[model samples]
Target: MSGHRTRKWVRVAGTAQICALLIGMAAGGCARLPYTTQVIHEDRRVVVTLQRETRPVPYSHPVQLRTDELAAALAGFSFREKQRLPLRWFAEEVPPKQIFRSDELQAVVPYLVEGLQKAAPDERVYFQVLAPGMNPAYEKDTTAGWIALREPYLHLTLEHFHAQFPVRKSEQWDLRYPALPPEPKTYLLYFEPGRFWETDPVTGQSAVQLREFLKIAIPASSR
Candidate 1:
């Protein structure tokens, strides 16, 4: 069975010579099949990867991260151009930016963490992470939702969103395609997190759509 599985797996995709040989061997000879280079993006807040043999890690105990620590962990949840490297420009709607601001997070994270520690099984900690607008006093962006205790799978979901030109979006605005929201407005997400989490074959199982302009990682540790 192991050998069968391994044989079914092609370590590296294909080589030019191998492709030509396979093409020559084909019954009807080679024909061009149109392919799209466009990348379909999954906008999600949290992404979870599962391994066959690994056990799921759930948040069961009280977890407290210092403002800086929470800030750092948040970096992974946000899109990082440098990390995407050569693929930087692919299918990006807005310039990559961390959704929540550090100072603003300090305001809510401590309380959220406190809730997490005390939450019972099946209970969730609700939070609204905010970021100051580029103009600080004027712009205040929000990410309001709840997070459950650590589980094998991700559970971060964006429920209701109604705001114009989120602070992070404004900060990342370098004359980007999306015109900034003229005013604060509530908009329904194309995909609801809870429904997407439980349904959708690909996303329901292994794939997660990233949103919040954003989990578990050693990131923005600098902040």
Candidate 2:
């Protein structure tokens, strides 16, 4: 069968078959994807956040760190890892065309679906993407009299994710970062929990309530 045909078949197979496949793999002691979970208690409800680093730099031996002096010299070049909460149902963004057949999705989707269904029973889940050069305002200013056009491939990509996951809603956004050179090359995945508006009695100001937030950074080549 063609590769596309195979993926179509897999999607049609649904979650039950996927769950059974996972169970079989678990029985063989196969390694699953890496994830961390965190639990938060606020508003008298337990909220969990599951996170996984999508573009982890693999460990490599230092070429010049054999001596203590050399190690000290290179210390300034190191970066601190971002801290994330560990919880069940970690979701990561897959590149545009790869979501349907990605090995990572195959490994994690079943668990993600099950966790959300059980933990946040009534909450609407989201799968969102943000791509570069998609700024509506920027495009409007530059194109003059033309409607801002989104990349056709990106539209198909969003549709693919909608069909693949049990997503209550899906969306795409444009990002504007002034400090860094526009990557024009990265895609971001966001998992947003349901939101609510609250008014402060003291200040009389309305603000949005943040339940949970997680993001996955996917590189351009991955798409």
User: Highest TM-score, which number?
Assistant: 1
> For residues 1-223, could you state the per-residue lDDT of candidate 1 as single tens digits?
5965654443223234456567777967666532222211112221111111122334443444354444433433333223253454562555444445555455655565455555544345555444454556545444554454343333444432323233334222233322344432332222223332333242243212222212323234532
For model 1, the stretches where C-alpha displacement exceeds 4 angstroms are: 1-67, 79-93, 129-141, 151-155, 160-223
Worst lDDT run of 10 residues, candidate 2, spans: 140-149
lDDT (tens digit, per residue) of candidate 2 on 113-185: 3333333211211222221223432321110000000111001101222112111221211121112221122
Superposition error at 141 for model 1 (Å) = 5.8
Report lDDT (CA) for all predictions: 0.39, 0.26
Worst 10 contiguous positions by lDDT, candidate 1: 45-54
Per-model root-mean-square deviation over C-alphas: 21.1, 24.3
Q: Distance (Å) between predicted and true CA of 161, model 2?
A: 2.7
- TM-score for each candidate, following the candidate numbering: 0.35, 0.17
